[model samples]
Target: MAANKILIVAEHAGGALNPSTAKCVTCARAIEDGEITVAVFATDGSSVAAQAAALQGVTQVLQIDNAANGHPLAAVLAPQIAALADGFTHVFGPSTTFGKDLMPRVAALIDTPQLSDIMAVESAHCFRRPIYAGNAIITVKVPADLKIVATVRTASFEAVADGGAASVEKRDVQVDLPTHTRFVEISAASSDRPDLQTARTVVSGGRALGSADGFRILYSLAEKLGAAVGASRAAVDAGYVPNDMQVGQTGKIISPELYIAVGISGAIQHLTGIKDARTIVAINKDAEAPIFEVADIGLVGDLFALVPELEKQLA
Candidate 1:
């Protein structure tokens, strides 16, 4: 493999590059003396390719435009990515839902081990990742003789700024795609608040929110602070919100600048998602709630009273 040559698979939709793509580049830069290139697969990826080219530390962007890549089916995309894996020492993608679904298939097709949720790059072949719900950290070293495929945990690294002038190139690769799968219509939740994973401030509620209407108070407070709204799995299981709003070990992991948990008991599973947050503020009437163990600031009070007062003060 060429010294320090990395190929990053871009995550995008509707011709716009996802922010996680830039974070993947950040992880790539951590590699000793690595030159980074981004790959975009879509029906018309010109717009996404152009955006990727502007990411700092990127050497180039590879654009593969085809109707077969319209929806990013793992079965269809893995083969295409594997065909382009030659000549690159490392292949990376953001540790997002998209990456989690795509990178393992690419690794299997290329006959290499796939590293998931990589938090740090120790060297070209050595990396660090979390295990056991983030209770422990483990270092892993892959075979130096084989190609490396990795998914970077976007929350662990800051995204690189977009100011570079990396050139975009077209790549034509041929692969056999499965006929058993097809793209279907997507149903996405609409929200005016910031995206939970990328938000600077997040305010989350738990089962104590009681009902869907109770969650509206959290939303109101979130709007006042210009924050994203999240929910614990307990809240979601109770049908207070859609599953997409869940934040926990089995849900979307977030590392915001500020995380405020209201009416939450702070289970270990929920704590794993926000462990990387710069500041954690917990408000629970139960002084014995486990969330206080990790919170930088703990307020032992009723969320119903505390939230309204906090919102008024901000206003």
Candidate 2:
């Protein structure tokens, strides 16, 4: 693997592009601002590749079209990606589920040292990242000649703005896929609400709400503000909310324009996910809850009483 140009692998599902790919492209460009190419793998990578090309700072999109790659994974997509990686200086990806699974296979396949969850690029081979559940930040570097493979933290970089007149090109690569990981039906959530991972505003509930019904405070507040719903680890562990809504060290990290924490006792783990939020608002019965330390707006009151009042006033 040679390090001459940075290559980003575009991720998608069912023909639609994932915004993380745009964010990854932005991140990669910020790191080196060098010649950048994106590879999209699918039954026909044409659509997704074109979408990648529309993003700013992208040189071109390489499409790997194959029947076997209709549904992509390491057993399938890695080979196509590996074939392209040898010609690049660096290979970057979003630290997503797909990237989490893909980078390891690529590293093993290409036999190069891979970096994960990098938050900042100090140089072509140097980066800053979080560890200890984001309790600490660490910086490290790699050799320029090494195949620098990395999974970038999405929020650390902005997504490329739309309307860039980037050009897309097609590639003819043979995708040999293994027969594994049955493709089960894809189910969309019933609610028309925005995805928590990408939403700009998030309203979270905590265990102070005694039951699942208590969690509706988030939904109500989120609806009023057109925000996404989130939950504390205690709320998820107690079955008052789904794990998808959990925001903590083990949960998804989000950097929204605003975050409202309802009844959540501030835990270091919980703070790690939401610390980057532009503004933090906390409402808890305990006036001295740790969440207040980081919250820009603090409300100490009974959530049951104050929440409905807030919904009424905002309405």
Per-model lDDT? 0.93, 0.83
Candidate 2 vs. truth: CA RMSD?
Answer: 2.1
Tens digits of per-residue lDDT for model 1 on 104-217?
A: 999998999989899999999999999999999999999889899999998899999989999999988887778789887988899889999899999999999899999988
| Strongest candidate by TM-score | 1
Inter-residue clash pairs, candidate 2: 3-89, 4-89, 5-89
Clashes of each: 0, 3
Candidate 1 TM-score over all chains jointly: 0.98
lDDT of 2 by residue, 1-315 (tens): 223488898889877889889888777876644778888878877777778878888877787777777765677777778888877888898887789888878888888988889888888889999998888899988876688889989878778876665677777765455677656665654566777878998889988998999877668878998999989999999998777788877787888998999999999999998978999999999988999999999999999999889888997
lDDT for 115 (candidate 2): 89
Worst window of 10 by summed lDDT in candidate 1: 171-180
